[model samples]
Target: MIRRSILFCLMIVFAVSLCACHKENPDPSGQNPDSSPTPTTPDTVTIAPVISGGGINLVAKLIYTVDASTAKVVRSTVMVRDDTDITPALVIDCIVESLKDESLNLSFDGIEYSDGVCVVDFDDSIFTIAGKSADLEDAILDCIAQSVLDNVDGCMKIIYRIHNEAYSTVNRHFAYDFVYMDD
Candidate 1:
C-alpha cells in the first residue's frame, strides 16, 4: 500500500511539473508557431535613363553653367519603379535621389500632393550653398519641374516652401513663385 502511494505521489508531481512548464499559445489554432502572420516583400524594378551628350532629349533638360557666364542644358530621363499607385511625392523623391553627382545639397522637409498639385517643403540647406549661381539654381528648379511634368500624370503644378513658408529666395536670386508643370 505504501509503495503504491509513493508511485501515485511521484506521478502527481510529474504531471504538475509538466503543467507548470506549459506555456499559453497565442494562436489557439496552433498553425503558426510564433503566432505572427507571414510577411510579404514588394516587387522592385530597374530603369536606365539615356545620358544625353550635348544636344537635347525628350526627357528632362538640366541647365547649368560651367564657367561664370556659359549656360548649358543636359537632357535626361528619370528612373521609374515598376510598382503602381505612384504618387507625385514619390516622383519628386526619385528626382531628388537621382541627383547623386550634382552636389546640389538639396533636401526636402516634406511633400504633399493633392488635386494635381504638389507642395514641397524644403529645408534651409538649399539657401546655404556656398557657390550656387543664379543659372545653376534656375536649372535645378527647371529640372525638378520638368522631371515631375514628365513622370507624374495628374500633377499640374509644384509649389516650393521653406520651413512651411513661401520659398521666395534661394540666394535671393530665385523668386520661386510656384512652377506650373504643364507649362
Candidate 2:
C-alpha cells in the first residue's frame, strides 16, 4: 500500500512539469528585455612611442681645421637620445645639431628623403658661393659627403645642393653622390 502511494505522487509531478514548459519561449529571436546593447570600437587613436635602446650612432665631421693640407673631415660618433621620435627629419635635424658649433663651419638648411635619394640642403654658401677657392669647396664637399654616408640609412646615395640647386663644378669631382656599398 505504501509503494502504491509513492508511484501516484511521481505521476502527478511529471504531469505538472509538462504543463510548466511553455510553447513560446520569447520567440527565440529578440532579447530578454533585461539585456543591454553591444559595444563598438572608437574611430581613431593617436599615441606617442616609448622608445628604447640608446638610439643611433652618428658621425660629426670636423669642418674647421687649419691644416686643410690633409683631410679635415675627422668623423666621431655621437649617441642621439631618441625617446619619442625617429622620423628622418628628426634624425637629420639631430645630426645637423650635433654638427653645429662656432669652429665647425657647416650648417644644413634642411634634409628630406623621397623616391630613393636623400636631398640635403646646405646653408654654407661660404664654400659654394661667388669666389671661394676650389680646394676649400672640395674639402667642404668631402666633409658633407662623408658625414651623410656615415649617418643616414635607406638611401643608396645622398644628393647635396646649396639652396636646392646643384653646385657647379664641385658636383663633378666631389659630388654628393656618395653611394653606400654594403659590407
Candidate 3:
C-alpha cells in the first residue's frame, strides 16, 4: 500500500509539472489571452514638411496678352529656392551659349513661385531667333529642358514660347510637338 501510494503521488507530481510547463510555453500563433497593447512597427510612421501660405512670389507685371488669332502667350515666374545648392544661372548661361549665333535669346525676368509649380519665364527674344539649323533648334529646346531638369527638382513641366507665342511648331527641324520629347 505504501509503494502504491508513493507511485500515485509521483504521478500527480509529474502531472502538475507538465501543467506548469504548458502554462509557461506561449501559443505558437501569437494569440495571447492577455489583453495588452502590441508594440507597433517603426516603418509605419511618416513625417512631412510644413509649408506656409505666404512663401509664393508673383510677377503679374511681366505678363503680356496675346491677340486671339495669334498663338497664346503664357508667362510664368519661378523662384529659385534661396537654400537650393544648385547653380541654375550657370545652366541657363550654358543654354544661351549653345544657341550662339542662332539669334535665340533667353532672359531671366525674375523668380516667382505660385501654387506648387515654379515658373521661369524668358523674354520674347528667346523665340525671335532666326536662321537656326535643325540641330541648333533641337539643342535650344534640349538646353532649356535640361536646365530645368538639372536645376529645379520641383518643376515637372516646362512651357516654351517665341515672342510670347506658344512654341507649337518649328520651321525646318521638328514639328510643334518637339517639346513633348522631354517626357
Candidate 4:
C-alpha cells in the first residue's frame, strides 16, 4: 500500500511537470520577452589595425606620434579606436599604427602586468626603429608609454625586454628597461 501511495505521488508530480513545460506564452506575439537581442555599436573611429588582435571598440583619447614638421606637438592627442585587448603591447601596437610615415614594424613577444607594472618582451624587430634621430625615437616611445598609461588602468610602469631579456636602451636612443607612468 505504501509503495502504491509513493507511485501515485510520483505520477502526479510527473503530470504537473509535463503541464508546466507546455504552458502557453503570455505574450500574444509568441516571442519570449527576455530573449530579445541586445544591440551593438562599433567604435566611433574605426581605424584598420596593422596587427589585428580584435577591437577595443570604445572611443578614447590616444596620443599619437606625428611628424613634427606638420604638427604643433610631436605627440598630439587624437580620438581613435583600434583592435586589441587593451593590454600594454596592443596599446603600443595601436600607437605604432597611429605614427605618421614612420614604420617601426615592431611587436611584443610577451607581456606581463602585475601590481601596476607591465613588463613587455619584444622580438629583435625592435631594433628596426633605430637610426631615426634620438629625439624622434624618444617621441615614439613617449607616445607608446603615455598611451598605455592613459588607457590601461592600474598600469603605472612599463619595462622593456628583448625576447624576455632585459635591455638598458632601445633604438640606441631612449633609455629602456622601464618607463614610468608618472613621467
Candidate that scores best on TM-score: 1
lDDT of the structure predicted as candidate 1: 0.60
Tens-place lDDT digits, model 4, residues 38-90: 76743465555568875444465556564644322255444544443467766
Between candidates 2 and 3, name the one with more favorable TM-score: 2
TM value for model 2: 0.42
Question: Model 4, which residues run further than 4 Å from truth?
Answer: 1-58, 66-85, 168-183
Error of 1 at 5 (Å): 99
What would the per-residue lDDT of candidate 3 be over residues 125-153, giving only the tens digit for each residue? 53443233434444555555655554545
TM-score list, all predictions: 0.53, 0.42, 0.35, 0.52
Full-model lDDT for every candidate: 0.60, 0.50, 0.45, 0.62
Measured over all alpha carbons after superposition, the RMSD of each candidate to the real structure, in angstroms, is 17.8, 23.7, 20.1, 17.9
Model 4 Cα RMSD, 1 decimal: 17.9
Q: What TM-score, to 2 decimals, does candidate 1 have?
A: 0.53
Sorted by TM-score, highest first, which candidate order results?
Answer: 1, 4, 2, 3
The superposed Cα distance between candidate 4 and the true structure at residue 171, in angstroms, equals 6.2
After superposition of all CA atoms, the RMSD between model 2 and the true structure is 23.7
Angstrom error of the Cα, residue 118, model 1: value is: 0.9
